[model samples]
Target: MFRRTFWFTTGVATGVWATTKVNRKLKQLTPENLAVAAANKAIEAGGRLRDRAVDFALEVRDNMARREAELGDALGLNAPVDRALPPPRGYAVIENRNSPKYVEGPGQKSTYTTYPYNRNEDH
Candidate 1:
């Protein structure tokens, strides 16, 4: 009787363990798990892109300052003179008469006819 009870308890414990292991494996193969993995990968990629952009901006700033200093030296000016120069300006919009017009062109006439047609009547 003692041996039978022990075997019964052991069998129950083994069955529970097997069931838990199968459930865990199935959960790992679920769509929700896959989506979570994909999202994590995307976030990692985005972080890398953000870091590269910051590095690129810093590089551009360093290069521009170096070039300005070189130009100042070649022009017989001191480094401090380059620092006194104003920051570069953005594009400017010019309003000139020769600019293209959105209106009708020369010698072109626009005619509008009424919805109801009356061939016998003249306007």
Candidate 2:
């Protein structure tokens, strides 16, 4: 009787332990848990992409501004005209199709205007 009781108790303990482990595994494998994980990952990726795009746009704007300033200096253009007064000492004012163009003179503007170089030139 004693041996039978001990065997029965051992069997019950083993069954309970196995059942608990299976339940935990099932919880982990549920569709809800997997979907939540995928959504979190997608949000993280989208945030990173947005940050990169913003940074790229800012960099492009800065470079364009710098290039514009350099071109103005190279063309010997005076500072952009003030609507209130005539252009400064060396600057000539020009009317632009889309925007008002201010410069030293038409002569300098045409002189410095660059044409596209040979496109197929051998390196």
Candidate 3:
């Protein structure tokens, strides 16, 4: 009789342990639970991407301002125009036209070519 009771107790404990483990595993594998986890992961990834894009944009703006200042200095302009220029007041005009024709002076060789070159080439 004692042996029967011991076996019964052991079986109940084993069943309870198995049930808890299966429940835990099922919760982990459920589609709704996985979807929520995936959404959280996507949100984290998007936040990182946004931060990188902002950093890249700021870097590009800074470089453009530096280059504009350098060009103004080389041209002997009295005041730096970029620093003084305000943001466009109205809808921005898109000037998509090609560059103006190069005019050569007397006794100057025509070195103009249609191929693109860096802006510093003129300096």
lDDT by residue (16-61, candidate 2, tens digit) is 9999999998987899988988999999999999999999999999
Candidate 1 lDDT, 4-120, residue by residue in tens? 999999999999999999999999889999899899999999999999999999999999999998998999786354447697899775533332332344686533333465664
- Shift of residue 95 alpha carbon in model 3, Å: 42
Q: In model 1, what lDDT does residue 99 have?
A: 27
- Winner by TM-score: 3
In order of appearance, the predictions have TM-scores of 0.46, 0.45, 0.48
In candidate 3 the C-alpha lDDT for residue 77 amounts to 72
Error of 1 at 11 (Å): 5.3
Q: Candidate 2, after superposition: displacement of residue 118 in Å?
A: 61
Model 1 CA deviation exceeding 4 Å by range:
1-14, 77-123
Whole-model lDDT per candidate:
0.78, 0.77, 0.80
Q: Which candidate order results from sorting by lDDT in descending order?
A: 3, 1, 2
TM-score of candidate 1 versus the correct structure, residues matched by position? 0.46
